[model samples]
Target: MNDRTDAGGNPGPEQPGPEPTGPEHTGQPGQGAADGLARRAAAGFHRTEDGQVDVLRTVGGVRGLAESIVPGVVFLSAFTATQALNPSLVAALAVAAAFTVARLAQRTPLTQALAGLAGVVVCALVARSTGEAKDYYVPGFYTNAAYGTAMLLSIAVRWPFMGLVFGFIRGEGTHWRGDRRRQRAYAAATWAIVAVFAARLAVQLPLYFADQVQALGAARLVMGLPLYAMGLWLAWLISRPVAAAEGPRV
Candidate 1:
C-alpha cells in the first residue's frame, strides 16, 4: 500500500535482490558430514601411556621430523658459508633428494620424504625465479597464509579442522560436534594450530620484507618444530577429556 507491498501484505519489486547462495542455499559438505569424518578419524586412536592422542603417533615421528628440518638447515648453512643462492638451493635440493633415496632404500614409508622433496623443489623454483635468496622462503610463507585461512574458516563453520584430521588419523570417525564440551575442546585445539601457523607468518613476513635471509631461516628453524610441538601438546591436553569423558555433549 505504501508503494512497496500489495494488498495481501507481500513486498513489491523495489526490494527484489539476488537469491541466496550461502550454505543454506546449497547442499555443500555441511556440519553433519564433517561430524562423520571427524568421528571416523578418532575412532581407533586411543590415548597412549602418557595420555597422548593416538593419531599423533603415525605422523612421521622422529624420521618425519628429521626430513622436515634437514633441508632448511642445509640451505641456510650453505648460504651462510658461500653467500650465494644457487649453491644454497642446490644443497637444499641435494639433502631432500638424499633423504628421499634413504627412505626408499630403507623401505620406509616415503610419504614424508616425497613431501619434503616437493617442498624443496617448490622453494628452489621460487628462489631461482626471483634470483633472491629470501624468496626461497616465499612458498612456506604462502603455505602458512593458506593454512591459516583454512583453519580460521573451518573453525568459523563449527567444523574445526582438528576434529576432521584427528578423526581420519585416529580412524574413529567424528561425533565430537554432538557434544558442546567436546566441540569446544576440538575448536580450541584447532585454533591453537591456527595460532602456530599465524604466528609463523606474523614473525617471518617481516624478515621476508626486510630480506633478512638468515633471520628468516633462523625463525623458520626455531618456530618450525618447537612451535608445532607446543600446539600439539595443547591439542593433546584439550583432547584428553574426549578420551576420559564417557560420552559426547548429550
Candidate 2:
C-alpha cells in the first residue's frame, strides 16, 4: 500500500493547522473592545483639549481669592453700618443665618467655611481692640460681648457661602464656552452684584442721613466691585483659545 490511510491512523489532507494559541489570535478582539470602553469613559470626564482637575484648580485659585476677600469686606462693612440699629444681636444673627443657609443649600466646601470663621474672629478682635464697642454700646461690657458673639457667627457662616458662590461661577464657566456666551454670563453676574449693592445703598442711605448708621455702604461697594470685575477678567482670559505659540501644554 502507499502508506496513506483514511479511516485508520493516517493524517488527513483536509485537517487544518492547530488553532491559534496566543494573544495575537485569541485576545485581540477582547482587547480592542476594552480599549473602546476606556476611551469613552475618558472622553466623558476630561475635556479633549484640557484636563478636568487642572481646569478646576486654575479657576478655583483665581476665583477663591476674589470671593473671599471681597465678600469678607462687604459683610464686615454691613455689620459696621448697622451697629446702631436696635437689637444688634438680632441683626448680626440674621446676617449669619442668611450666609449659613445659602452655603448649606449650595453644599459649599469645608475649607471655605473655616476661612470665613477665621475672618469673623479677626473682625471681633479688631472691634474689641479699637474701643469701638466701648464707644457704641452703653454699659459697654455686656453690649460689646453680645456684638462680638454676633460678629463671630456672621464670620463663621461666610465660608459656606463663599464656597458655593465661587463653585457655581467656576462650574458655569468651565462647562460652557463661547465668546458670546461667556461675555453675556459675565455681564449678567456683574449686573446682579451691582443690583445688590445698589439695593443695599438705597436701604442704607436713610440710616446714614439720619446719623443712625455710618456711611460704610460705600466702603462695602468699593470692596466688592473690584473682585467681581477681576473675576470677569479672569474668566475671559481662561476661556480664550490657547494660543498657537503656547502649543497645547495649557
Candidate 3:
C-alpha cells in the first residue's frame, strides 16, 4: 500500500514513495549532502535532546546576541552623529573585526564571528562605493529577497524547506514529506519565513528609497534578528506534525 501506515493506523512496512525533485527531497541523487545540510540547519533551531526548543541557545546566548547587534548599533550611531559615511563604515568594520579578534583570542569557534565580519565588510564596501550611508543595508535587502524567493519556490515544488529542516528535528527525516498534513503544516511554516522576508522589504524599501538613513537603520535593526527569532519560534509552534494515529494515507 502507498500509505505511510496501514489502514487501521498501525505502522506499515516502510515502502519508498515517488521521489520528489528538490533540495528537501531525499530521493534526489544529492540526498546525502542535502540531508546533511538540512540537519545542520535544523540544529540551529536548538532542538534539545528532549525535543524542546532552547530559545536562549537558538538566539546564540548573550555574547552571540551582542556580536550581532552591536556593530549595527555602532554604525547607526556613528552615521547619525557625524553624518559621514567613511567614519561610520570604519567604526562598524572595526567593531566586527574586534569581535573576530576576541573570538580568536578566546579560542571559540570563529564561524559566527568570521561570518559577521564578512557581512560587515560587504555592507561597508557597498555603502562606501555609493557614498550613501543608507546603502549599508542594501546587501541585507538582496539577501532577504533571495532567501524568500528560494523558500517560496521550494513550497511551489511540494517540498517545503521547513520540512527538510524541522523533519530532522522531529526525528521524522524526509518521511514527513509523505504525510499530507505534515506537508501542509510545514508549508505554512515556510510561508511564515517568507512573510518575515517580505515584511522586511515592504517596510524598509520605502525608507530606503526615500534615503531616510536613520529611520532605515532603525527599521533594519528592529526587523532583522529580532523578527527572525520570533518567526522561527512561530514556525516551530505551527509546524508540529500530525500524530501517528492520523498519519499519511494512500
Candidate 4:
C-alpha cells in the first residue's frame, strides 16, 4: 500500500507537471515580442481614429464658422488700408502682400501668392484702362463709388471661389460643411462686408454729387474711418479661437 501511494504521488506517464506560467511557456521570445507589438499597433490605430473624430467635431461648431470669415475680413482691411496710403502701385503691392500673408497663415503661401499676383495684374489693367478712357472715366468720387460697388459685387460672386482657392492653397482636406451651411455662412459674411463697404460709399455719395468733396482723397479719408473700424472689428471677430474650432476638415 505504501509503494502504491508513493507511485501515485510520483510523476506518472498519464499526467505531466503543470505547464509553466512564465514567459518561457510561450514558443519563443520572438512570439511574445510579436504579440506585444500587435497590441501596441492596435492601440495606436484606435488613438488615431479617436483623434480624427475630435477634430471633426470641433470643426463642426461655431468656432469653425467664425474662422472661415477671417481671411475675407483681413483681405478687405488690407485693401482699404493700402488704397488709403498709396492709391496706386504701392496700394496694389500692399494688397498682394496682404493676400499672400493671409494665404500663408492658412498654410498655402505659394499658391496664394501666385493668385494674388494675377489679381493685381488684372486690377491694374482695369484701372489703367478706365483712367485712359474719357467716356469710362468720371470724377474721382463717382469713380470711387463705382469701384466700391464693383468690389462688393465681386466679393459676392467670388466668395465661393475664394473659399475653394484658400482651401486648396492651405491643403484643408475639403469642404467639411455641407453646401447649404457653407453657402449660408459665406453669403452672410460677404454681405456683411459689402454692406459696410457700401455704407461708407453712401456717406460720401452726397458730398461727391454735390461737389463738396472734390478730391477722391478727401472722401477716402473721411469715409475710411468708419469702414476701417468696422473692418477691424470683423477681423477680430473672425480671429477668435471659437472661429478656428469650426473650420471643416476639407
Ranking 1 against 3 by lDDT, winner: 3
| Candidates' C-alpha lDDT | 0.65, 0.33, 0.71, 0.34
Ranking by TM-score: 3, 1, 4, 2
In the range 1-250, model 1's lDDT, one tens digit per residue, is 0000000000111111112233322334574565454544343233455435533333345665577778889999999999999999999999989989997899876755777787788889988999999988887776676777877898999888777655444332355566687778779888887888778878988999998999999888777765666676677677545434565311
Q: In lDDT terms, which candidate is top?
A: 3
TM-score of each: 0.76, 0.30, 0.82, 0.32
Candidates 3 and 4 compared: the better one by TM-score is 3
Off by over 4 Å in 3: 1-34, 242-250
User: Who is ahead in TM-score, 1 or 3?
Assistant: 3
What is the C-alpha lDDT profile of model 4 across 140-163, one tens digit per residue? Answer: 234344544653564556433222
Q: Regarding TM-score, does 1 or 2 come out ahead?
A: 1
lDDT of model 2 at position 24 = 30
The digit string of per-residue lDDT tens for model 3 on 1-250 reads 0000000000111122122343444456666666665675565455656555555566566675666778889999999999988999999999989999998999987755666677788888898898889888888877777788888999999888888777766656666777688899999999987888888889988999999999988887777666776777788789965456666321
How much does each candidate deviate from the true structure in C-alpha RMSD? Answer: 15.6, 26.7, 10.8, 27.5
Ranking by lDDT: 3, 1, 4, 2
Error of 3 at 51 (Å): 2.5
Question: How much is the lDDT of residue 103 in candidate 3?
Answer: 83
